[model samples]
Target: MRLATFEHLGLRRSGIVDLGGDGDDGAVLSPFPEGTDLLEVIRTGHVPATGAALPLAEVRLLPPVEPPSVRDFVTFEEHVEGVRRSVDGTAGVPDAWYDAPTFYFANPCAMVGAHDDVPVPPGCHALDFELEVAAVVGREGRDLSPERARDHIFGYTIFNDWSARDLQSREMQVGLGPCKGKDGATTLGPWLVTADELEPYRDADGLLRLALTAEVNGVEIGRDLLSNMSWTFEELVAYASRGARVRPGDVLGSGTCGNGGCLAELWGRRGDQDPPALRPGDTVTLTVEGIGTVSNTIVPGTTPVPIPSARKRPRARP
Candidate 1:
């Protein structure tokens, strides 16, 4: 089932996409609560039905989760090769990097929904896009073997790991990481397709042959096949949860895939060189074969409200 958590007419609910019959008949069918995203719904096992089954068109699609916990891994070899080739002459996996899987936490708060305008932060001259697949964890587990990892997955969704190339390059050289460089913008979903629906495509390699593509303002920019991933999802899950428990709703993102996954990989584009790095009017769309497309717009950044300073509290009463 293509499940979604959405708000329509001020009412929030979770439901399976009833893409049956006419294309215009799409509806969100369950009534849960505001925070009822796909991961939460699946963990319960009881799919709740909604009122009036709000037609999908009128409702605004929010990020699959208002606040999503994201854990990203660089599992595709081709992507690594492409990036290495771009950054330097270095190519192929360094033995130590392959000895065990490694991961990084992308921003949880940067999550934006389909059609939402992703902000291109001020002074960031070079911005790029990454096309990826994400696995949503359904049940919490620790030391889960490869055989059991798939069972813990709830579903799959698309992820766009937007980057500030210049910031990332400078930060990585210091060996600290692309902390502020990466925390800028990351996006997910028009909807989250459940594991049951994606099961047929899942293989021993856990690689699905999906045609993935990216376009800027309707112009084709990048394309690749999901089958090109070097490491399988099961391997990543096992490696990630070796000792720590991966809880339900914790997202694992398949880092950027090969070819045009990012500007740095596609072209030698980096900061200052590109005059217009994703302005307010630009739009980006990423599409995976089985799942639908997710499109987002670029917008000017707004200063987030500052948290008021806390007042010194009076002495507490005995």
Candidate 2:
């Protein structure tokens, strides 16, 4: 089912979306049981099948699920190769990456629904967006094997890992993270499609075969098949669960797909001639087959908020 969380008159509700009609705005929804929210559905591993249809256009779309914790995993080989190649011409996929999936914790508070304006975080001059697919964790488990990891996933949704390439490049030199470079805004919805809805797309090996794409102002920038990912969501979940617990409402993302998911990669590949950094009023849209498209427009800050920098100080002894 195509499920969504929406708001109307200051109330947030979870529901099933009915896209059977004629027009774009003709979308309609049927709410879940009263007082039930998305987080509750994920926790219970079940979403009721019946609710009255209400026009989808009449409500405000919220993130499909407001996760308790979010973890993004880099599993696409092409994307990893592109970023690595940007850093050095001879670099190939990281060898260690083949042995295990790598992941990081992200700020869920920074998320906004699809169509929401992505405010230029103060000081972010080179803002960019990453097109990704996220897996929502369900139930609870620890030390889960790859064969069982898929069972813990409740659903999937498009993830836009909004980025500040300039800040990311500078801070990553310290080797701890993409920290403040990221953390500002990450977009996560139009709606969430349950795992069962995607069962037909899953291959014999357990990898999903959805085709994914991203565009800026209606111009396509990138595209890739989700099946091309070197590691599957199951492996990512298993790896993430080693010595740790995977709980309900935790999100795991399939990091940026093929090339052009972000400007940093584009600039690294094409140099100074690449497209300009995101300015106010630009819209970025990402689409994944079997899921949906998410579009967010950029809005610049009124005043510049450059990141503070530090300089070396001379020692008295010297």
Candidate 3:
């Protein structure tokens, strides 16, 4: 089922995308027991099939869920190696990556929805977007095995991990974080497709078989089969759940796909043929087959939030 959270009558509502009415002029139906949000529905673990449908045009869509927390994992080796190569011309997915999935928490408060405007932070010379997908945790669980983790996935949503590459490049030199570089505006969705909706696409090995494509202003930048990911959602979730509670409304992202998903990787592969930096008025559309698409426009920020200066090194100890 395609589920969404939207504003209707000045109030936020959650629903299933109902296409059977008006011959394709589909509406969104608040699942049985309307008024509660998608997060509550996920926590419920079962979407009741009966509800009243509202015209799709009657509301403005919001990110499928206002996640309690977001953990984005770097599960694609090619993306890691390519990004690392672009940054330093060395360091393939380090042996540590092979040891286990690595991830970081993002600012859920900064999340936005499809067609939302992403403010281009002033001084961000190399604004970029990541083509990615995310799975929302259905309920709370800790110390889950990969086998158990698979059962807790509620649904999937498209994520455009907006980036400030130049700022990112500067920060990583200190070996700490992608902090301010990311944690800005990350786009989350047009809709959320429940895990059951994608069941038919599951391969024999239980990995999802779906295609992901990214486009900027009508130009196709990249495409890849999601099944190519080395670390499955199960592993990412399991790793994240180890000794830690993963609760309903939490999110886990499948980092960038292999090749051309971001400007830095494309630039490294193309040499001087770099794609232009994302700028005001530019639109980016990311689509995952079966799940849906999210298109966002770059807009100017009201004022530049000055970038913080890195701390200077202390005098060498004698």
Give per-residue CA lDDT, model 2, range 1-318, as digits (tens).
888998876888888887876745777888987678888888986777657787877888889888888898888777776665553343667688878778889998988998888888777788888888999888799999988998998889999898877777777778787887788888998898889999999988778999988888888888788888778888888888999998988889988887777665676666552677788889999989988888899997655556567777776683
Tens digits of per-residue lDDT for model 3, 51-108 = 6777776677799999999998887787887777665566556888888778889989
CA shift at 179, candidate 2, in angstroms? 0.9
lDDT (Cα, tens digit) per residue for candidate 1, span 189-220: 87788777866776566687778898888888
Worst 10 residues of 3 by lDDT: 23-32
lDDT, candidate 3, equals: 0.82
Sorted on TM-score, highest at the top, how do the candidates line up? 2, 3, 1
Residue 95, model 1: lDDT of: 73
How does each model score on TM-score?
A: 0.85, 0.91, 0.91
Q: Residue 127 of model 2: what lDDT?
A: 84
| Model 3 segments more than 4 A misplaced | 20-34, 46-51, 89-91, 307-318
